[model samples]
Target: MDYRESLSTGPEGSMQAHQVSHFFSAVDVARRGRWDDDALRQLAHLAIPEGLLGPRGNLVRADVTLAQARWYLEGLVDYAAFEQDESLRFGRLALQLWQALVAQNPQIPRDELHEVALKLATVAWSEVRARRIRHRARMTLDTRRTLWFRELDPRCYLCGYKFTAGARDRFLRRSRSPLTPPPLVDFTRPRTKERHLLIEIDHMQAVAEGGTNELDNLSLACGWCNIVKGRRGSIFDVDSRPIGMLDHPTLGWLSVPQPMWVLRIVSMRGRCEHPSGCSANLANSELLVAPYSSRGALNPANTLVFCGEHDPWKDERLISRTLVV
Candidate 1:
C-alpha cells in the first residue's frame, strides 16, 4: 500500500499561465511508467464505472480484497496527478466536495449538478477571500497619487503583470497607454480591488504589522501579486523584485564591476526588456545591450533602470535565468 507524492503544473495562465497540453498526458505518463505492474494493469479490463474515481466510488469497490482495492485506489491517485476529469489532482484534493453537496440534495440530477457546484464554489470562495478582501475594499488610493501613477502606468511591483487599460481613444481622442489608473473604487467592487488586471494599493509595510497608509509606505502591484504578497510584514519577502534591480533581496553577491557595462545597461533603457505582448521586440539582447560580454544572457525581467544615483557595483542586480539544455 505504498503511496508517493508528485508535483502538479498547469498551463502558463495557471500561474500566469503559458501553453500546456491536455491534462490526460499525466495518465499517459503514469500508466506508461506502470506498464509492468500486474494487478494495476488488470483493472483497465475491469471497466470501472463512468467516473472510476467519482464520489462514493469506495462503495463499488467494497467487495474487492485488500490488495485489489489498494492498487485500484493507487492507480486512481496516479492518474489524478495529471488532472483526471472528476478526480482529485493528488492526495484527494477537494476531498468530499461533491459528497457534501449530495448530503443535502441526494437526488440532484447529473446535468444540474455542476451548475449547483459552481454556485457553491463561487460563494464559498468569496467567503474564503472575504476577510482579506474586506480590508482593502474599504479604502481607495488618493486620486492625486493615482493620477500621477496613471501617467506612469507602473507594472505590478511584484510579478510585473500589466494592469487593465483605461478608456482612451485614438486620433481625435488620446490613445490608451500601457497603464492608466483605474477610476476610484472600493470594497463594493472587489474585482477592482483584487483582480490582477487592476493596480492594488499594497502596504509596503503590512497593516497587520502596524504599517500605515502614509504615501511612502504604499506601493503598486497587480491584484495577483498583492494577493500572494498577502499579510506578510514586509513586501520584500516575495519571489519577484518588484521595486527593480538595485534592491533585489538575496542576490547581493551579484555585481557588474565594469563601470562601462553599468552605463550601457542604463543607456539601453528598455532595449533588453521584453515588452508584454510584442514578441518581435524580444530578440537576442546581447546584440542590443552587450555583444562582447558573455557572462550569461540578459533577461528583460532583470533589466535595470536609472531612477537616480546609485553605486553600480554594489547596487547592480541580476535575475537568474535557466538556459534550456
Candidate 2:
C-alpha cells in the first residue's frame, strides 16, 4: 500500500518517513514468499530510534507515522501463519514498533508496551473481545454503578465496609445515643484510612493506557482508594500515607464534628436528604427530598434527609415540606 499520504511535518518527519518506506518494502518481501532476514533486520532497525526524545523527554501521544507503522505491523502479523516463523518475525516487529514509540516518549510506561506486545504476539485479538471492550468504555456512569453493585455487592472491595441499604443508618445510630448530644464527625480531619462504606467504581487498569471497561478490569473501590489509585497501574503502588486535615471556614481544621455516615450520604447525593426520616428505624428509603435541586439550581441549604417514599405534596402538587432536624 502507498502509505506516503500518512506523513506529517515534524523534526522526526523525515526519519519516520524512511521507517515507513522500509516497513512497506518488508511487507512486499513477505508477500513474495521470500525469507529475507536481512530485510527483516532492516525492518527491526527502523523500529529503533536514536536520541529522538520528545519535548521535556516526556512520553507524548504517538505521532501519525508511528501509529501507521504499528497498524501495518499488526496487519503483517495477522496475515502470516501463527505456527510459522514469519508470524513470529512480524509479531516481534510489531513489538519493536511499540518499543520505538515508547523510547521516543519516556512518559509511556514500559509495562503498558509489554502488555500490548504480549497480546499481539499471541494473536489474542478478536472481534468479540474488541466489542466487549468498546461496550464497557461506552457504559454510562449509572450503569457502571449498577453493574458494580450487583457483581461485588455494596461493600467496598478495599476496606471491606458493607455500604448496603440502611448501613448508614446503623452506623449513625451506633455512633451516638438518643439521650446524649448528637455525635459529630470531623469532615475537616484528614481521612487516615479508606472509608469502606463510601463505594466508587475504580478502573483497575486506567482507561488512559487503553484499559478496557470489562468487568475483569473493573473493581469496587472506596472513595479514598480510588483517589489514591489515580492512573497508577495498581493500588499497591500507593503508599498508605495519612492525609493532613484541610482547613475550612465553616469546618475548622480539627474542631468540626462531621459524622462519617452523613458525609457519605452527602457525597452520594449532594445536599439531598433521605425522605425515610433521619430516625434509625425510618431511614430505610433511598428516596431524597423532592426537586433534589432547587430553582433548576443546586442549593446546599435545601438538601435534607428523607425516606424513599415519593413526596406527593412536593412531587405532584409542587408544595415542598420543610423538615426540621
Q: What TM-score do all the candidates reach, one by one?
A: 0.24, 0.26
Steric clashes per prediction: 8, 19
- Per-residue lDDT tens digits for candidate 2, residues 216-292, read 77766545545545554321233322233334333233222122322223334432233443442121222333223
Once fitted onto the true fold, the runs of candidate 1 whose alpha carbons sit more than 4 angstroms away are 1-151, 167-194, 233-325
Q: Which ten residues in a row have the lowest lDDT in candidate 2?
A: 316-325
After TM-score superposition, what is the CA distance of residue 24 in candidate 1 from its true location, in Å? 34
lDDT of 1 by residue, 81-169 (tens): 32324332322322333445556567887547556555544433332332232344234435325533444545444433334444222
- Identify the leading candidate in terms of TM-score: 2
- Candidate 1 Cα RMSD after full superposition onto the native fold (Å): 20.3
